[model samples]
Target: MNSFLSTSTARDLSLIFSGQGQQRPQLESILFEITIETSTCETAFADIQYVSWMQGEEEILITIGAIVRIDS
Candidate 1:
């Protein structure tokens, strides 16, 4: 994914394993730069796994799951 899509996708995924986000058993992906933007600040991440909470075959809880860059 490009930076824009990566950023948007990253924000969609707020899961941080044991962080505040709802936990899932598993979620994984490769590497890229991602940024979360808002009125006052911006955060960057890379090398993440995007995962989402899905119920049944359709309903979605959290939109995305990703690993934030350790050095970011």
Candidate 2:
């Protein structure tokens, strides 16, 4: 009797929105509004920056810093 074992290949896939040519101005506005609304009661800061290439490739970087109060 001959026995055979089959192995399966696994892959992880991710879907991302592609930037066509330039950064959308509405994106910046939306982010700013959301950050401001969430920071009303808390001392928080949100910083956003983006870099775009000539080939319509871009990356968005966001940094958020906040302080919380804890009582014991």
Candidate 3:
């Protein structure tokens, strides 16, 4: 028989804009950097069991899971 073990974590991040004027190119850059950094850590783990992303009007959601194989 074969089996798999998995673990996952999720976090929601928000960048509040007080007004339309708050929108700026730099803000987008920062958000992009954050997304990249969050995903990079997964590469070091074994196979990624699952991953998902959801975008909201004001926040971004990320879910990541990792799996490891056990020998019996």
Candidate 4:
């Protein structure tokens, strides 16, 4: 009953992957496809540069963004 939950803020792209060894209940693995300029292909970012609008919102944002959970 475990799985993965993925979401993209820029696009309404969300899905779940569930199986035998993939039962981690996290977004640990991502096989995404992105489009840039006139070319489209699969890609992933090694690191993210996240900027917060609020002064005291760094911890909150990081915590929320790192969450990939299941409702048990």
Candidate 5:
């Protein structure tokens, strides 16, 4: 069974669209570089920036039970 996970891009939009983000470890945080490969999986996300209450946050709504690959 696959679990649902919520992820979002921060201030830099490149994080989500271009897979560009910090690789260094933080004080108390685990960072996973996620890439949305359409060829491998179905579309399971929606751009909710326009409908979100806080539009400035630039939120991307991911569907529940979406499958993703995680690398360590």
Candidate 6:
């Protein structure tokens, strides 16, 4: 089944993290910088920033059902 991936238009959003909690330090973290280019008519995703409750997040709502691959 598909899922909703909450993403942001802000390039600087902290998507992942690494820190010390256990006796050993946590492993390094990675972030996938996804660049999405779509026509204005595309409906796979929607810009909900204005209506979003978390206005500061600059969120973009994506429908995973329409997503086939990361390379697209």
Q: Write the per-residue lDDT of candidate 2 for residues 1-72, one digit (tens) a residue.
A: 232221111111101222334468665221111223454645323232132232132222223343334333
* TM-score attained by model 1: 0.16
lDDT of 3: 0.33
What C-alpha lDDT, on a 0 to 100 scale, does residue 14 get in candidate 2? 9
| lDDT accuracy of residue 39 in candidate 5 | 80
Q: For residues 1-72, write the lDDT of model 1, one tens digit per residue.
A: 333222324433433322444344574443444443445333334323335233222212222343345554
Tell me how far candidate 3 lies from the true structure as C-alpha RMSD in angstroms: 13.9
lDDT for residue 17 in candidate 4, whole number 0-100 = 30
C-alpha lDDT score of every prediction, in listed order:
0.35, 0.28, 0.33, 0.30, 0.61, 0.63
Give each model a TM-score.
0.16, 0.17, 0.16, 0.16, 0.53, 0.58
Shift in Å, residue 34, candidate 4:
1.0
State the lDDT of candidate 6 residue by residue for 3-71, as single tens digits: 676778775554422222334445555455556667543547778999999897888877776543465
- After superposition, candidate 2 runs with Cα above 4 Å error: 1-43, 50-72
Per-residue lDDT of model 3, residues 1-72, tens digit only: 233322223222322332233756664422222323445455333324233233233233333443323333
Candidate 4, residues 3-65, lDDT tens digits: the string is: 222323332222333223465766465434332222531332221215434323221112222
Question: Between prediction 4 and prediction 6, which has the larger TM-score?
Answer: 6
lDDT of 4: 0.30
RMSD of each: 11.5, 19.3, 13.9, 14.5, 6.5, 4.6
